[model samples]
Every structure is written in C-alpha cells, then in structure tokens.
Target: MSLGAERRHIRDVTAWQPRVPGVVEVFHAHYTEYAYPMHVHDAWTLLVVDDGAVRYDLDRHEHGTPHGTVTLLPPHVPHNGEPVTEAGFRKRVLYLEPGALDTSLIGAAVDEPDLRDPLLRRRVGQLHTALAHPGDELEAESRLVLVRERLRHHLRPRPVRQPHPDERPLARRLRELLDERTAQGVTLGEAAALVHAHPAHLVRAFSTAFGIAPHQYLMSRRVEHARRLLLAGQPPGEVAALSGFYDQAHLTRHFKRWVGVPPGRYARTSASLT
Candidate 1:
C-alpha cells in the first residue's frame, strides 16, 4: 500500500507465524493516531518504518524510528510507542525467538536499539516480502539467516571476509535434490542437512554455481513441468497439483512469469494452431 496520499485513521495490522524456524511471528502495522500502552513481549522485536515515523520509550529511555532506521527491542523490555508526526507510521516487524540472538547481546541492543544500516534495512524489507509468500519457504529461510547475521554484526562488530571456495559439488548435489523433488519441494534446512552444508552456504553455493537461487531453480522446474502438462491437455487445476504448486493461482503466477502467458491461455492458444 502506498503512503502517497493521506489515509484514514484505521488500524491495520497483519500478523502471522511462518514455517521458517527462529522467527516467532511477523507483524505489520499502519496507524494514523493510535498509541501503544507500555507492554513487554517474550520475543525480540525487529522493526522498520516505511512511512512517517515512531517515537517510543524503551527501558525508560526514549528512541525514535525515522525512515532508513532498523529498530531492535530486546525481549522483556517495557516499551510504549506513538506516531512521530501527523501522518502517523507504517511499519514491518519480525518477532524472533529469544535464542535467535544470544542473551549476552541484549544489553548492547538495549543500549543502542536503532541501527542506521541501509543494506540491513533493504534486506529486512526483502525478507518480509519473502515471508509473505506461502511456497517460498527456502527463500525466506535464506534471507532470515542473512538478516540475523547482520543484526549480530550491529550488536558486535566483526570483520566480514568474502571467500571464493570451490562449491561445485555441493551445488550439483542440491540440483539433483531439486530435480528429484520437483513435485514436492524441499526446505532449505532439509537440503542443508542432506547435503552436509550450512543453509546460507548452501544457498550461496547453488546460486554461484547455477546462476540462480535454489528456490528460483525449483520454481522454474515446477513451471516447466506445468508447461509440459498443459501441452498434454491437462486442466490447469490438476496441473497445479501435479506440478507441485500450492494451487491454480500459484501455478498461474509462476507459469505466466516464465511463459509470458497463463496456463489456460497457453494451452488454448497452442491447441488452436494444431
């Protein structure tokens, strides 16, 4: 939703628990005039404001979330928030499990909860987008690990080195796994365990080797399978299930993305020529 024009003061909130591990919940909100009373949560609150801003008191200290800022409220901290301007605020949030970040860093997070990292802000937004999709668990999990690592870096600075280690074998093994399970996709965690590599590393290896991410590779496989099924005169609804899509809508989305036409249109158009 765009914040280009002023929107009415109606509380809008979306919350869900994704299948990805370590993330307890995803919460998104847009409020014009509402104010939050002092409360505490059992999970760590990671927030980013997309429009307007938020002014909050965390642990008796005042903090504000301006645009381009990533906010972290440690678990068990008492906080209260309200809009920073008349325009109110639109924000995306992630509630991570307590263990996602070590307890030792809680003090650092409480000391300085707001981070002004542009890359981190962008990655968090992408992570939210990935989490919104139902069948993109692997992409969500991959982004989550990177976001978590970046959060840790802010709490405790570390040197990041880019390595070019050979990972072709690992990448090939992952391709084989994807090919075998195209009808029923595998989770990043499962692929990592089966391939004996770290989840993030596995994703990196696959992308580096194949020029596409693992989830994208699987989706392309499914889309191609759907194409073949459609050419065989199979109905779009049945092709969706047979090709490992969540439903017909999901099939149409990926199919159109790859083929430049929806399943029904493609089937009918090709048949008309024959």
Candidate 2:
C-alpha cells in the first residue's frame, strides 16, 4: 500500500515542527502543482524519490533529484524544492536524529561523510517499511544498524584530491591547514601566519576563492569533524575538546543549529541501535 499524497506546501516555520523523538517521520509528498520555497530545518532530511523528478537548490548548488536517488540535507542549510515535470514530484522523506543512528556494530559505519551506499539504500527501504507498519520498533532499530554499518564502510574511503588549476600556492596551504587543524582548532591569526599573509588580506582572498569567509569555512570544517566524532559514539564533551569548541555547551549550540539535533541525542540513538 502507498502512503497517501500530501499536497500542502510548507512556506513558513509554523508549518513545520519536530517529528516524534527516536522515530524518523516518513512522508510521501506529492507536488503535483506546487513547490516548497527556500527554508531550513533542524534535523537530517533524507529525500528518496520514487517517481518524477525534483529540482533542489542547496547552498547555491542545484541538484536534479531522480528516482532511486537520495538527497540528504544537514540542518539549517537553506534549500528549495520544486518539480521538474508537469506530472510533478513524488518522494519519501525520512527525518532522523543523530541518536537514531547509534549502534556499536555500526558506529564506525555511520561516521562516513557520504551516505549513499547500497547497504544504506536498503536500510532506508527497511525504515520505510517499518514506518508503514506500526509497533515494530525492534525491527526498525535492527535495520537501522545494518544501514549504518554499510554507510560507514562505504564512507571510510580516503579523501580524493580533485584537480584545481585555479588554486594558488597560499590558498592551497590555507586549505590544508584548515583540514588538518579542524579537529585541533586554528585561529584566524594563526592561519594567517601560516601563509605569511595579513589576516585581513587572507580573509578577503579566502572568501573570494571559496565564496564564504575564512572563519565560516573553518567553522564548517570543525563541525564536520564533530559530526564524525559524534557518529563514532564520542561524547559531546570529548568531541568539543577534539573539535576545538570551547566546551560541550558551545558544541551543543552549534551542532544543534547546524545538524538539527544535540550530540547527546545523536549518541543515544546511535547507541540504541547496537
């Protein structure tokens, strides 16, 4: 049986609220003649299309979402979704907390950057099945662990260097420093010193090349590191220390703002799956 199509268009915060705790709210949305304007959320939004095509713009990047494909949005990033066909778009969205991913067996698996893995796809399918049937929390959680493991393994590959002809030597060094010190923390002054440039010049040049301020880019890297640690079952306090946040509360505030959930919840849900 198919979940009935919901045609409402959500354009404001009042139209959205947090779904049930621990459970990923699944919805089959049909945009026959409507679209969702730019908005942001506080949870992981996983969109899996089953029919038609959906065009989404996230952080200035445009994507054409097709059937059998998934799109993941980390919280608070502005995005807009629209149908590419007159037939409109039909898709399932799964809203999950970080804690819903914790499983000792799959702990490492969920830590990967990329979430698109065959195993993860299967697990997402299982989650859809579980949502279709109520009162099967145990089975749902079990499948969640399997999906987490596959995602972790698939994401554990080493970073690949993409060719960049426009990258200057100093800019490249700055990028490297950001990556290396993301978990360790680096101040603007410190980064500027590394490249022998003044802080103001560095800031302007970095922003020109990356389209975001240097400090913002640094914060994003730190958050990315924190996310991996949290997914790997690390405590918020520890992740804060490692990721250069001043304290657990600081990390919590930013993590929630960006990821749409606190570290504790992410850790707990991940742990429950094991």
Candidate 3:
C-alpha cells in the first residue's frame, strides 16, 4: 500500500528470527516521523521499502530506496534510514549473517548500494514471502538464489575484453601469477608488470590465451577451491578465507557467478545428490 502523501495510522515494528539456516533476522516496520540515527551492523543489511519512500546514508553518501530500490549495506558500514515523505514509509528488512552472501556481492552493493531494478524488487518480495513460512525452505532458497542473481547483475560490471592472438605468452605468464597468488588479489598493473606488458595489452593477451580475463580465470580457480571446501563441510566464512576470497560475501558473489549458485546452496544440493 502506498503510504503516499498522507500519514497513516500504522506505527508498528514486527521483528523475528527467520527459521532459515543462514538468515539472521527479519523485520518489518512502518514509520512516519522516525529518523534513525546513523548506525552500523555486523551483517549485510538488506532492505526493501514497500510504500512511500525511505532514505539512508552509507559512508557519507545519501540514497533513496523507495518501492523499487533495494538497500544493500555491507557489514561494518555505518548507515541510517528515515522516511522521506510526511506519510513516512514502510520497509521490510533482512539482516543476513556475515557469511550469508559472497563478499564480492556485498562489495558490488558497497560500490552501488541502491539497486533500482524492478525484477529484483519483485524477487525480494518473493524471497521474503517464502521466508515468512517456516517449512518451505526449498522455495525460500530458490527465491533467494534468483534475488541474489538479479542483485549481482545490477552490481557487477560486464566489460567485454577482446584478446590479441599473438599475446598468449604474456597472458600465460599472468595466468601462472594468478594461480600462484590466488589469495592475494593481483591488480591489472601487477599482472602487466610481471609480464612486461601494458595493462590493457596484458588483459587482452590473457583473454586470448585463456579465453577469459586474468581476473576471471583466477576467480574460477578460487571458486573451485571454495566448492571443494564446501563439499568438505566447511562453512562459508572459512571457505571464503581458505579459497582466497576476501570474505564470505565476496566468495558468494564469485561462487554464484562461476558455479551458478551460492556456496551454501551448492553444498546442500551436492550433499543431497551424493
């Protein structure tokens, strides 16, 4: 319901713990004049303002996440949410576990927090509704996957890197470097310096030699490592560190992109299949 320009009589806060394995907390709140003071969370704060409009600030930058925008705040990032209109706003929030998502997805949100995608908004509702039910975990997880995928689409940049057929040698050296230092992220310049090539040239050459960018190949290796860890029953947080991902959320983003699903879900499905 659109709270619109008129203040409604709704003033309530309903919060609970989702019975789902990875979710931390779920909350629904309606406000008219409430302005939250700047705060920080230890988990990824996912919010969907259903009606009217809500505004928030992350790392000193303000954002408006109304009906269509999804508010994504990475862990430890300070933020505040308040109503935008006199009628205030209504919001559904999910405070995900620190290890709930891949650290890279959260990084994407950190770079572009206000995800203004219509499909993502709908998927959020679907995921939330599924989460509201306690026993339909399969459905909830299914919806969560789609929601995350859509969010990732908005958060990640897809640049086409064309390869130079003759530069495979340089690209090969960069690939070796990436394999050697999977945990420590290598910059384009670093890869270039290692092979005595310009950054752009090295990128093209790497793509030519491996059919994927230097970063992509490295990430694929990391994803494979994370997958093994998951299959071994290691948690996402530990898997993230072990797989050379910066964090669980970062691992999630890359894992989903490479493996077609999040690590937790992959592990569960693999276990069931096994």
Give the number of the best model, judged by TM-score: 1
What's the lDDT of the predicted structure labeled candidate 3?
A: 0.70
How many residue pairs clash per model? 0, 11, 10
Q: Which window of ten consecutive residues has the lowest lDDT sum in model 1?
A: 156-165
Residue 92's lDDT in candidate 2: 67
Query: TM-scores of all models?
Result: 0.55, 0.49, 0.53
Better of 1 and 3 by lDDT: 1
Cα lDDT tens digits, model 1, 58-119, are: 75679998779999988755566888887788898888888988888877887889999999
- After superposition, the stretches of candidate 3 with alpha carbons farther than 4 Å from their true spots are 1-10, 157-274
Q: By lDDT, who's the top model here?
A: 1
Query: Tens digit of lDDT per residue, candidate 2, span 55-134?
Result: 86765567776556556655434456777986776676766664554333132222322244555666788777775554
How much lDDT does each candidate structure score? 0.79, 0.59, 0.70
Judge candidate 2 at residue 179 and give its lDDT. Answer: 65
What tens digits encode model 3's per-residue C-alpha lDDT throughout 87-150? 8887888777777767656556756788777888888899889877778889987887787677
- Model 1 scores a TM of 0.55
User: Which should have the higher lDDT, number 1 or number 2?
Assistant: 1
How many angstroms is residue 112 displaced in model 1 relative to the true structure, after the best TM-score fit?
0.5
